[model samples]
Target: MKFNRSFAVLLVPLCLAFGLFALAQDSDDRARPAIMGSTIFDWTLLPVKVSEKGESRRVLRAPTATLDELECHVTTLNPGQEAHPPHQHPDEELIIVKEGTVESLVNGELKIVGPGSVIFQAANQMHSIRNAGDTPATYHVIKWNSPGMLSLKKAAKKMQK
Candidate 1:
C-alpha cells in the first residue's frame, strides 16, 4: 500500500487523542458502580480479617448499584471489648445484632440491645458498640452515603495535620 508522509503525521496525533480519551473514560467507569443486579453474599464464605478493634467478616466494601459508599461487614466483639472509643464519622451506619447482647452508646446515651435489634447511627454522630453479654457479641455493620467517605477521611486527616 502507498502511504503519504503528511497523512501519517496527522494520523499519529489523532490516534494519540483517541487513546487518551479512552483512558479517561475508563478511569470514570472505575469510579462508578461496578455491580448492576441482585447479588447474594454469604457471611460464612467470606474470609475473616482482624482489625485493631476486633475481628470482622467483610461482606462488601464497594460502591453498590444505588449507593456510593455501601459497606457491609460482620463484626464480633469479645466480652468486655469495645470497638474503639466512641467516635463519629460522616457516613450513616446501622448495627444489627445477630448473636449475644451489645451495649450501644449513641451520643453519650447507653442502651443494651439483644439479637434481632437494630441500632442506627446518623452521620457524624458519636457512637460505640461493646459486647454486653458474657460471650462474644456478633453484629452486622452496614453503612452507606450519597457520595464516598474518602472526602471525609481526607478532611479529618488534614485537620489532624
Candidate 2:
C-alpha cells in the first residue's frame, strides 16, 4: 500500500490526539473509585486537628456513584474566628450547624443562626462562616461536585497557574 505524504502527516497527529485523550480518560477513571455501600463515621473516632482558629475533623472525601466528588468535614470555630476569608468556588456546599451559634456570609449578607440550622452556599457565590457566640461554634460542611465539575475545577486551577 502506498501512503501519501500529506495523509500520513494528518494521520500521525490524529493518532497522537486520540492517544492523549485515552490517557486522560484512563487517569480520571483510576483517580478514585466511586464510593459504594453504607458507611458509618463516628464523631469520637474521628481524629481532631487543632489550629489557631479552632479544630477540624475530616470525615469523608471521595467520589460517589452519582457525584463526581463528595466531601464532608466538621469545623469548630473559636469565638470571633472565621473559617476562612470570604471566598467562592465552583462546588456548592451545605453547612449544618452542630452546636453554638454561627454567622454565615451568604450572598454578601451576614446571617446568624444557632444549632441545628442549615445554610446552603450556592456555587460561585461568596460565602463564609464564623463563630458568633462566646463559645466555640461547630458545624458540618458537605460539598459535592456534579458530573464534569471536577474537570471544570481542574481547568480553572490550570488557568490560575
Candidate 3:
C-alpha cells in the first residue's frame, strides 16, 4: 500500500494533536477528586507532622463543589521561628490563630495578634507568619483557588522556568 505524501503530513499533525489532548485529559484525571456533601476532619484524629520550624497538620487539599481547589492546614510555629519568608501567590488565604501570639506580615505591615485572631492575606499580596511570643503559636490556614486559578498558576510556573 502506498500513502500519499500530503495525507501523511496531515495525519502526523492530527495524531500529535490527539496525543497532546489525551495527555491533558490524563493529567486532569490524576488530580484529587472533588469533595462532595458533608465531611468531618476531627482535630484529634489528624496526624501532626514535625518539621524543622515546628509542627503541621494537613486537613485537606481537594476541589469542592464550588471551588477549583481548597486546601487547609494547621501550623504550630515555634517561638522565634518564621514559617517562611514573605511571599505572594495568586490564591488568597485566611489564618485563624488558635494559641499563643503571632506576628503576621499583612499588606506590608507586621502586626501581632494572639488567640482567636484572624488574618486575611489577599491574592497576590505578600504575607508571612511567625511566632512573636515566648510560647509556640498555632494557626489554621485555609486557602482556595477559584476556577481557572490552577491554570494561571501553571502558566506562571512555566514562565519562571
Candidate 4:
C-alpha cells in the first residue's frame, strides 16, 4: 500500500466525522421508544432490563429526559406475576388499563383494574402490579413527578419493618 500523506490527511477528518455520526445515532435511549399511538409528543420504545425470566414482557416508554419525567411505559403482565416492584417514586403516576385486567396495589389500596380503569398514584406511594387473572393484563402507564418528600427507593427501604 502506497502511503500518501495528502490522502491520509484528507481521510482523517472524514473518519472522525463518521465516528461522531455513529456516536450521535441513538444518543438517547428514549428517542426511539416504541409507543402504542402517542404522536402528540415524543414516544419510543424503552429497553427494560428484566433480570428474572418472565412469561411475557412489554413496554412503550417515552422519556423527555430523566427516567420518570414525562415518561410512559405500556406493560403487559402475565397471570400470576408482577411487572414492577412494590415501591414508590418522587413522581405522580397514572395507570390506565387498555386491555385485559391487572391487579395492582397503589398506596395500600388494591384493586383489579380492567379496561378503562384508571388509577392515580401520588408521589412516594407504595405500588405494585400483579396479574390477577387467567389472561394477560396490559395497561398504559404514565408517570409525571413533581418534587416529592423522598425518593420511592429510599422510602420503600425505610418502610420495611
- Find the number of clashing residue pairs for candidate 1: 0
> In the order shown, what is each candidate's alpha-carbon RMSD?
5.4, 3.0, 4.0, 11.4
Candidate 1 vs 4: which has more TM-score: 1
**Model 1 error, position 15 (Å):** 15
**Number of the predicted model whose TM-score against the real structure is largest:** 2
User: Could you tell me every candidate's TM-score relative to the true structure?
Assistant: 0.74, 0.84, 0.82, 0.53
RMSD in Å for model 1? 5.4
Q: What are the Cα lDDT values of the candidates?
A: 0.85, 0.93, 0.93, 0.67
Which 10 consecutive positions of candidate 1 have the poorest summed lDDT? 30-39
Model 2: what TM-score? Answer: 0.84
lDDT of 1 by residue, 34-131 (tens): 75356789766899988655688988877656666678889998888898789987888899999989999877799999999999999888899899
Weakest lDDT window of 10 consecutive positions for candidate 2: 29-38
Q: What's the true lDDT of residue 84 in model 3? A: 95
For model 4, residues 1-161, the per-residue Cα lDDT tens digits are 89899999999999999998877885744465543344543324444544342333334334333343355666766677787789976667788887777788876888887789998888768988787888777777776633332356567678984
Error of 4 at 87 (Å): 0.6
Deviating ranges (above 4 Å) for candidate 4: 1-68, 147-161
